[model samples]
Target: MAMFVHLTAAANTPRIRRAGIRADSRGQGGVRGVYCFPVLPSYTLTHQWLRELARFGPKGALSAVHVRLADAQEVLVGHYRDRAKDAQQWLTAAEAVARVAAQPDPRGWEVVVPRAIGAREVHRIRAVPQVAGWRYLPGAHGTRPCTCVGCRIRGEYGGRRLRERHPHPLDGPPPPVPVLLARIEAAGDPGDQAALLDALHWFGLRRRGPVDRLARLAAHPDPAVRRELVWAVQGWSTPGVAELLDPLAEDPHPDVREAVADVRELMDEQES
Candidate 1:
């Protein structure tokens, strides 16, 4: 599914002129930088560029392409400085930036510059996507992670500014527990089910549901299912949950015992 977004011009930027220029470039529409949110659980980076295309009209017909730079384009150095020798990371970052710069559209442009950089350190250039051949330059800038979740995970490239990408998880956010649980129950792929369950547990979303649903999970036959149920019940301490939790606490699986211990601590706290 496409990531939803609101794309707009960076104040006072003129809509491309239409007169002699082709009507397509005449500013009937605009271009903008696509934001990518990788931290959110979907692991699907929000396709800001596609969203921009949707908003600005067809890439060939749009008039102005607005790029949100001041906030999103400065984190390329730290992500690469130390890991220069790591080919995979370097290549991934390189490819993402290249893909962004090489987009085929005349109505848009990408505004890229270094953050915390002084005028003397580098020549700051804004590469409109249609202009072609744009790249980043390096310099001393107090860089931060890209504010947009996708950029944070995917990283950006500014001409010569080769920075490192952050190591945050790519999944943006977990689907609501009920949603994930239902998918797990319906999914034929064990890996998919396990991945969802693990995500639910990792994000600490387990507390939002009923202990009984989880207790019933303990006997699900599939060891993986039983294992995840253990995590789901790990911290449950609702008053009537003891009956549901006690058996799993002594279940043959070490995972079950560990979950029981975890829940016991919750019960102990409630008693205190």
Candidate 2:
């Protein structure tokens, strides 16, 4: 079934122009060459390139292209590869950058300059937070795991098994509860809030820390945040925890209500 879908997708894929290469209508839409790097272009620029690539079928474009620099040319390649729906692509733009600049830094960490190819230029590339000591450099063919002290220790002692080590998190202790709470309170971005909430749940579970503040976030404007909050509150049988969850039964979002139902069922099971 998966093979049929793959073949169907390949057949229906539109072609696009590749960097330093012209469009070949007669050729299969599969990628000819990919320009791999580590950064991504702006959304506007990415959309423009996607529009241009769609002119050709999917087979004619590259499968996975990375842009190290934010240059127009590089961004075009990255966006094209992403939109081409190539199953071969792995790392996100941020991951690609981390892989390229994986060398150890005496100052603690290295930085990548985010210069674009043409008029649009960024001052610096934002650092992608990674697990401690897991430096990876992209090889001539693809990316490989770093054998640094941190990565090595993580492989053995950390949850990462040898086979599952490729996409492991950075080594180092998690941030303090206060720090996470501060970020959650101040975070305006929904994505940031969601991640912090997830981290809080794990941190609380491991340490059995206080989560009273998290319960307050049930009123968060974003339904996604509320849903995550529901998950975070599970297994928390503290005083007033049930009262805090009662109102969520009538939550505006159906998913949130469903999560509340699941939690209620679990609680009933525990009592019985």
Candidate 3:
């Protein structure tokens, strides 16, 4: 039998100990499966989702349910995005282990067993660190809190109030970056425009972004808005990022100028 680890709420330990893990509708079209990670040599990688999955539960501990599956058992394995896109592939239990082991960073990867796991297949349940991997995304803490509806899932354990405390400009279909930037430029309230400007940073964080428009914010009337503007362009690695930050470096307000220096220093550390 192959070994795997299923991360579940510590509250469900008794139920799992009694009836084993029953496959629920964790996939598309109500497809039920026991979702788990392969028990690899690296314990951290094996239970990578321990922290991420814990976000769905109340303020409670999470337990790792060790599972022993037959090598012949059929399973579905792919990156979590593949499961999201309904592009999962069928593989033997052993094959899933091999597939996951080959990946350099398998944080968003998954293995789905399409059937229930009997209690006998349960090897043991272990207590793991509540804080294991990252939440939202890797290095998410480096950026400001995101208020987009999609980023803030309903019923998540913590941070609901904090995430919702800010205005969610992305409650629905958001306009393109250029369109939204135009709106922010024309928007009446400088405060609201600053808030929107902050949100725009995450749009193309690691991609080429609209830096030309962002560069113009160096001349905003309010120092606070210009300060926020400094943060808004901090994450872009685009060619024009330096050009945009150049003007902010000479900003009239010390705070805005300071923010530009901080962003450059922080981004330099990140890039290095």
Candidate 4:
């Protein structure tokens, strides 16, 4: 009867593993590169949105607060037709700002938009410390409950209402919903249009929801509206929605094509 003693691998195996890791680190296949996704930080993304909003800021602050720039380049490329001199100018400016803001580093810039604040007030607020990134977003602060048109709509349609007018410690009472909506809508700024659409989308109004009013805008002459419409439709997935987006997929604008791709992803997600 022969019993064999178990033999163990060399203790140097651990050191070998460490060396291999170190070697991998020195090359592109290193640990750092393993998780190397393009680091588009939230702040940078927000900066892009802000720059797009600024293009629509010739109106009130609320307008400035609402432009969505998730795909600024796509939007520009899709909708920037030489329709009007002013439109071209605005598009040019928006594109330039977007290019800068979309850069990896936006340098801690902030644009603030307060409820019912004017240009002077915005300038004053921008000077505040810890407000380095303060951006005066156009539109009323939808924090606290208020009787404004926007708020009223919010209360009526935004599900169940609270028993009393309790305000948030940080947000206070929101401005009247109607006022906010009016301000957001009356501001013809393209940025404002985009921003309002963004707000409506976020407010759970996308698709067959309360924000269905926006769908009519899908056919707007402005390609910008068409682009935003594509984005908004992502939240709405019903039968025939694919048919609605098919035309947009073939849109002459590259941005529209890209928008189609985004919406397609949403469709794919829903299917999955």
Candidate 5:
């Protein structure tokens, strides 16, 4: 037999006691499933997802649902990002445990089942600490604090001081409009997507960046940059935001166009 753990809001404990862990595709992909971790020999490793899941899990008490599976039961296992991107392959329950066990740092290892689990499948529900496992990213503690504009949300506690102390090379407040325009232009190196995204974030934060200058970003080769441009324009207070988004609505990439649609809705909301 192979043991697995699923972390969820403890409020659901009663329901889970009856219905087990019903699959609901929380993040990307059409796969309606539950995410779990194989229980290995290591105590800390067995519940590694606790703190990381807490970061995204709904606020309040959280618990671990212990699940048991036959050695031959099939599942999907891989790096967290791989599972998110739908890049993992199906492995037997025993093999998944073996793969995770072999890893030196299995913080990002994940297991996903593609369908609902009947209540009978659950072995037990155990209460665990609300705060356990690594967060921000695995092994984030030993490294310098990351003050990336993306990582440091405005309303987050200590965000300002975090940036002041351990500044990210690519993230900070935007310069004056003219200087920012020059910096965005000079950040054209193919390998510098992080710099490009950080600079684009400045546009979103400032909101009043000249629409004309912002329009030029639609031409950047990266679809992600173009998508970020539409998201940035969504915050513009100026009247030309609608006009600026016209070209993006017709962007070749689906994601860019999707971003354009969101901006359009924001404009509609503001007008009404």
Candidate 6:
């Protein structure tokens, strides 16, 4: 996902365009500074929506939230000419809503919305298969409620109270390390490949064998895959992991080089 902030001349002052809205900032030392709002890709926006839902109970009406989100998206589409950018804004808005609905709070914090309206929008978003790696909702499966002490305490408050609880893990065991490794190897799509690498990092590989398997991807054709490979190597302290990373220090891509530097710095910190 690429973020673009456009600066244009307007009358005597410079106007900054971000998220499709223009704002004026005071000139400093005869130079006008451009104000830029961080442009969040659809994936990031969906993640943010999940975080917001987890923190605050979804009390507002769905229509109201939809309108607000739509306005933000319209502004983005207007400013950015890229069709992908426009698609991302719409997809992010819809996916975020669907994720919130799927993970309804049992404690009644989940906002009630017209099922038809919400479902219609979700269906529309899902119909477009162009967006790769679009999952309906993450962590939606499993029936077992969290038995953690925090969950237990939060359960006592009922619908009236809004107490924050750490999200309970789902009931099922995580996918085996080998399965994830194979998925990473088989993934042909850049986005899917990157995501799998990230998941592998999160799941962690205890054995040196899996790390060795992952390190081989450092020579992958795509820079993104190489970068993720570099990231995955940071956690492993195996004997030849340094050997795997050393060649990457001279990688043509700045991002790959930076990742190698980060790993080296972290290794230094650990050794010291």
lDDT of each: 0.37, 0.41, 0.73, 0.37, 0.77, 0.40
**Candidate 2: Cα lDDT at 20:** 23
- Could you give candidate 4's per-residue lDDT for residues 135-172 as a string of tens digits? 22323236444543223323333323442454333222
Q: Give the per-residue lDDT of model 1 (tens digit) for 1-272.
A: 11111222323123221111111111101211222221112211222233334322322322222222222233221221233333212123233344434544312222212222222222222223332221121221355534233232122224113222433353334467676656655654443556545644643433445555445565655566566665555454454556766677777777567556755655564464
Highest-scoring model, lDDT: 5
Stretches of candidate 6 above 4 Å error?
1-165, 168-174, 188-195, 203-209
TM-score, one value per model:
0.31, 0.34, 0.57, 0.29, 0.67, 0.35
| lDDT, residue 190, candidate 5 | 49
Query: Whose lDDT is higher: candidate 1's or candidate 6's?
Result: 6
Name model 1 segments beyond 4 Å from true. Answer: 1-167, 170-173, 188-196, 199-203, 236-240, 266-271
Instruction: Give the lDDT of residue 241 in candidate 3.
Output: 77
TM for candidate 5 is 0.67
Residue 167, candidate 5: alpha-carbon lDDT: 76
Backbone clashes for every candidate come to 40, 23, 0, 29, 0, 0
Tell me, by TM-score, which candidate is best: 5
Candidate 4 global CA lDDT score: 0.37
Give model 1's TM-score versus the native structure. Answer: 0.31
Model 2 per-residue lDDT at 193: 62
The per-prediction CA RMSD against the true structure, in angstroms, equals 19.8, 18.4, 16.6, 20.8, 6.3, 17.4
- What are the runs in model 5 whose C-alpha is more than 4 Å off? 26-30, 81-87, 174-199, 206-225, 230-272
Give candidate 5's error at residue 204 in angstroms.
3.2
Q: Candidate 3: list runs displaced more than 4 Å.
A: 83-86, 138-141, 153-167, 171-272
Query: What lDDT does model 1 reach?
Result: 0.37
In candidate 4, how many clashes are counted?
Answer: 29
